[model samples]
Target: MDPKEFGEFVTAWCPGCGNFAILKTLKAALAGLDIPPHKLLMVSGIGQAAKTPHYLRCNGFNGLHGRSLPPAQGAKLANGELTVVAVSGDGCSYGEGGNHFLAAMRRNVDITLLAHDNQIYGLTKGQASPTTMQGQVTKAQPLGAPSNPFNPVAVAIAMKVGFVARGFAGDTELLLDLMQQAISHKGFSLVDILQPCVSFNKVNTYAWYKERVYRLGEDHDPRDWSAAMAKAMEFGDRIPTGVLYREEKPDFAARFPYLAHGPLGKQPVDRDALREVMETFA
Candidate 1:
């Protein structure tokens, strides 16, 4: 379970990119959790962050733009033995795949979502993304983004998601700790990472995040809904980086009637009988 044995492909990412830290930490987290490459399934949509699966030596599904969730969920449902993790950028997850994000929360699927919230669309070469702060100018928006940036952590908390957490890419140890917790959680888990896109996003640099980011205090209770909401809504001067909320609930795998006997792949079925039953319905 050596971290070095996880990823094989050479990445074409620029130096000082927060993604490098994220990728390395992710491998470390998996190794620490004793999850081998064959047991992990990484899903992602079209974006710079979506290329994470290409670098990792794991089962990967590079889906269409803004559509990583459907396949990830399907794969997990088919074989509950797999550990599913979806990696996506702010633009791909918050803007393009916003609807899917909401749906995943509603279903409370048994999967982890790692959101690379760098605040800008780095893949498109400096564009104002869904999480981009207001008044931050980009190549696509010379006058700055017109709308206010989306608060994914707050939204997820409001939706009563099973788990909501935040991490900083600049802190490798913190990121690894959060990822391990997210993947180990039984129900849906969301970890919104504050990544610094050095090339495209100049505003939110490594130093910029280090100044504002602070960890949640020991007294803070993640189970307290109101308290967690307060922690999630904190922005501007000081930002909290830690678990916001977590509550156990019935996961999709348990609720699905078809999976009552366990994963579909693990159950023995009579294909002829199933086909005959389907023909009767037709």
Candidate 2:
């Protein structure tokens, strides 16, 4: 499959926005893996990054704010054959959808989460987001951001999520590799991409990230839990990017061995049994 198979169109995004690189990398990743538009499903919550689906030529769902995960998991449950990928921004995924993010990790759903961590609320015009650096001043917080920024990769690793990786939008090649690996993982995978909101976030610019971000070398073993934890906490001065951790475990559907027979949608429903159960509530 050619990467151009996912053609581009007019987007409601600012020039030099990191989202453009992410979108391009994602398309390349999907095509590189030979995943056709029909076999893929993109789910996203309301935010600037949520607009990713609009530019993709695949099955997609634009859902409520902070509510992409639930529907992504639902789609996977309904059709286990589909490749589910959920996309959202720092605010949508780590702020408003914080609880669901934790739940999804616990469930270990067979899906990939592309978190566009630009550190500010771009769509709402420059408010500090969940991943915003502490004490950073923004339009919404003129007094400086009081709360500490959320560390998604650290939290995911601590929770023992099956797959956890970090990518920088500035590095298209590495980001594409990370996206492909995350999507291919059998359990919940998270690629917390460090995206620069050029229009809203001035601190973490392209040059800023370029200086600090470096790929994990061949010496770093992704399966080493302790090593991965140390790598996850390395955020200042020198930041690491790449597959931080990987552990294959039973996914949500795998817990139910009977599901292997077929997806719930394909299975014949026992109307009589369902009716009897429904009548009990009467």
Candidate 3:
């Protein structure tokens, strides 16, 4: 399908909304991959980030609050042929669904997770999110966020996720490249996009990000875990944006040799055997 097909689904976001750029970039990346629309599945949880699935014309699942990863993983396990992508906001992924995030990474499921790192909970009228910088004033944290923000890249690296990357919404081309790479990667891929909430978050605005964000170019080695960790730590003055780390580790499906033949959903089950199993439970 053409980009226009997906473009029609996007409505008016706030002026200079970073999500718009991200959506456009994602569409371009999908087009470049030349994958059939039917083969792609976009899943999301409750938040402004969840609205992305609705805005995209591709097959999508709008799931419960902070529960996008579970269903996405289920879908991948059931039908390995489909390309699964789970999208969520910082609060949805890093805050409320933190446990799920850790588990999914450990499992190393074949899926892509795109986090809209706006640093604040936009849908909830500007509450400080898990990634919201310390000392950043918000509606919930009037005196500024006291605790340190969750460093997603570092955490993912620590978890030994197969693929980990960071991008900025303003740079659509770069973001698209990262998305393409993440989707193609075999195991769990986390692409944290530094998005700006035009309406609610005034701290990490477009101008503010432009001043600090820098891309890790061709010379940067994504395979170097130590270097990637060092780069991930440098976020204040010079925020490095690109693939932080990548390793060709076995996915959860691969480790479980039984699933290697084909997807469980596509495999036929014997009615007689199933009946016998059910009778034992009964």
Question: Which one wins on TM-score?
Answer: 2
Which digits, one per residue and each the tens of the lDDT, describe model 3 over residues 1-282? 477656466465676888888888888888888766788899999888778888887789999878999999999999999999999999998888899999999999999999999998988889999999999999789999999999999999887788899999988878999999999999999999999999999989999999999999788898888888888888898899989999998899999886977999998888999999999998
Stretches of candidate 2 off by over 4 Å are: none
RMSD from true fold, candidate 3: 1.3
TM-score for each prediction?
0.96, 0.98, 0.96
Evaluation by lDDT, superior candidate among 1 and 3:
1
Name the lDDT value of residue 72 in candidate 3: 97
Please provide, for model 2 over 1-282, each residue's C-alpha lDDT reduced to its tens digit, 9 standing for 90 to 100: 998887778999999999999999999999999999999999999999999999999999999999999999999999998999999999999999999999999999899999999989989999999999999989889999999889999999999998999999999999999999999999999999999999989999999999999999999999999999999999989999999999988898989876888998789989999999999999
In model 1, pairs of residues that clash are none
lDDT of 1 by residue, 7-83 (tens): 66788888889998999999999999999889999999988899999999999999987888888888889899999
- The lDDT for every candidate, in the order shown, is 0.91, 0.94, 0.90
When 2 and 3 are scored with TM-score, the better candidate is 2
**What are the per-model C-alpha RMSD values against the true structure?**
1.4, 0.9, 1.3
